[model samples]
Target: MSHDPSGHPAHLGRPGHSGHPGRPARIADVAALAGVSIGTASKALNDTGQLRTETRARVKAAAEQLGFVGDARARALSSGRSYTVGMVTTDSFGRFTMPVLLGAEDALSAGEVMVLVADTRDDHVREAHYLRSLVSRGVDGIIVTGRSADARPPIEVPVPVPVVYALTPSTSDADVSVTLDDAAGAAAAATHVLGLGRRRVAVVTGPVTARSAELRAAGARSVLGDRMTGEPLFGDWSERWGRRAVDQLDRTHGRVDAVVCGNDQIARGVCDRLRETGRSVPADVAVTGYDDWDVVALASRPPLTTVDMRLDELGRIAGRSLLELVAGGRPASTAVTPTLVVRESTAGA
Candidate 1:
């Protein structure tokens, strides 16, 4: 076993298998092995260095030989900083939310910060409870994720740490926010149909209360102008809604040449209904959707062309913002630009 200048056995490779009963080496053991004071060893290992270079190296060498891993909990407690961040999200856990969480985790992990997560299921009481619990736990920062910008988070209590909101607009004064550019995404969809020479355009959207749906509708109307006909159909975020919207479109506007759906699911429903009614896609009618769900788009009869909201980028930005707040930086907000992904669905054949 390699020993530093001191007599303590350096159990580098050889397990301290022999009789000297390898009492788990502690800071004292490292100090003794390095022939340095315990305080010096602690400071050197923690990088709180006031110690000489030679002393720091010797202490580090001793720790390496002993396979010492510092206890983060103990360090945190002693320093009065938990080094943890709390992430509070809506209960739905949709595919969109997953990427956002991944981005936040990646950023926090890179900074050596720990994260604790909670889901509120959009329940007001549960949201309050989770927020209070996080504050009580001494988390250094918080990230609140909501389903949309119009969501009203129920956290009424004041938080002691910095808080950042992602994929949602902040209703509170303390939070820094990041959100998707929904109006732009929707307008792009409408403009695409117009470019294809489709004079009659209609919208099939999710529940009116959903901020994304509202913004998308606004964008569509802005591009289509007064000549655009038919009342916007509103329904749940499901394939059934998509199918029903198509039937409604046919009933109300027999000459409809294009439709913009709230999401890929709705677009798929519209496509199925259109084919059943004997309409040739893009040849007779072009359809567009949002969320760019690859599986559905790839498998569709003509494949679906949808908007990619850049969800992964949204997550990455949210994560970066939270870290900045935790590092004593001012709260900052960001808006993610949506991209249009053209596929076979809307291609004129």
Candidate 2:
């Protein structure tokens, strides 16, 4: 048996492992294993200092082998940072916010940062309370999100830590935000139908009050031009609305070769209504949808060809932008273009 300078076993008889039995491993043990100074070991472990890349890797490897974990409280005290971030959302059901949160976690976890979630459920007073609480906790930054893709008022924080908007955007041009390009998504749908030799395309979408609905209509118009049968039929975001819109289209626009819907629910409803009336999907009238929601899209009779907003990617970008802001970098707001997912609905077309 060999002993270290302090009369402890130099090795625990395990490869790359060092430290005495019945005691937690420390930085001193890491330093000894890596043949580096204690200060150098810390610098490497914390990813600081101007140590050589190999030296840092060696120190980190040694630390990992010894299972040496740093004290978060001590690190926070020394760095003057909580190493935590907050995510505020108005999506109580987590339908939209959950994917964004998961994406943010993927990026933030790489930095060893923790996230605190605050769901305000669309109440201003509740939002204010959550903001205050997060600020008081000294979060390094924040990411604001919501169910809609529309712009909302920027959140006000007492301490003014970096904030990044995800899914939902900030109305202020000065604030950094990452959002879906609804118009582009609609345009993609239009282009796809056009490529399938579809003419007389009619648009069925949600209420005009929603920015997403307006943008989507405009996008389809931009691509379809005169091929678009008539003005968009705007109602509500529901399957019933979708079914009613189909009836309205039949009475007003006559026969449409393709129907571009605002969302999966609407597309599914359109397919169902068309089927009931002896119109075979794709064979007679091709249909496309926005928001590739699995439950709605996949559950449709022939499934749906829809737009994927890639919300998770948007959240990831938002998280990275927040990190940049916390590090004093000014990241410009960005809009992510949605991708088209082809399915059975547009299989023949």
Best by lDDT: 2
Per-residue CA lDDT of candidate 1, range 1-349, in tens?
Answer: 4455344444332333211356556777777667778899999998896778888988888887776776777888897778888888884657777777888888778878877989889778898898888888788778788666684543565656777778876876556788899989988988888998888888889999888889888888899895467867889788888888887777887678888888899899888888988998878888898988887777777789899988778877877787777777885677888888888878863
* Residue 274, model 2, lDDT: 90
TM-scores, one per candidate: 0.87, 0.85
| Candidate 2 overall lDDT versus native | 0.89
Highest TM-score: give the candidate number: 1
The list of candidate 2 runs beyond 4 A from truth reads 1-66
Count of backbone clashes, every candidate in sequence: 0, 0
Q: Output the worst ten-in-a-row residue range by lDDT, candidate 1.
A: 11-20
TM-score of 1: 0.87
lDDT of 2 by residue, 187-254 (tens): 99999999999989999999889999999999999999999998899998898888888899999999
Off by over 4 Å in 1: 1-7, 11-25
Local distance difference test values of all predictions, in order: 0.79, 0.89
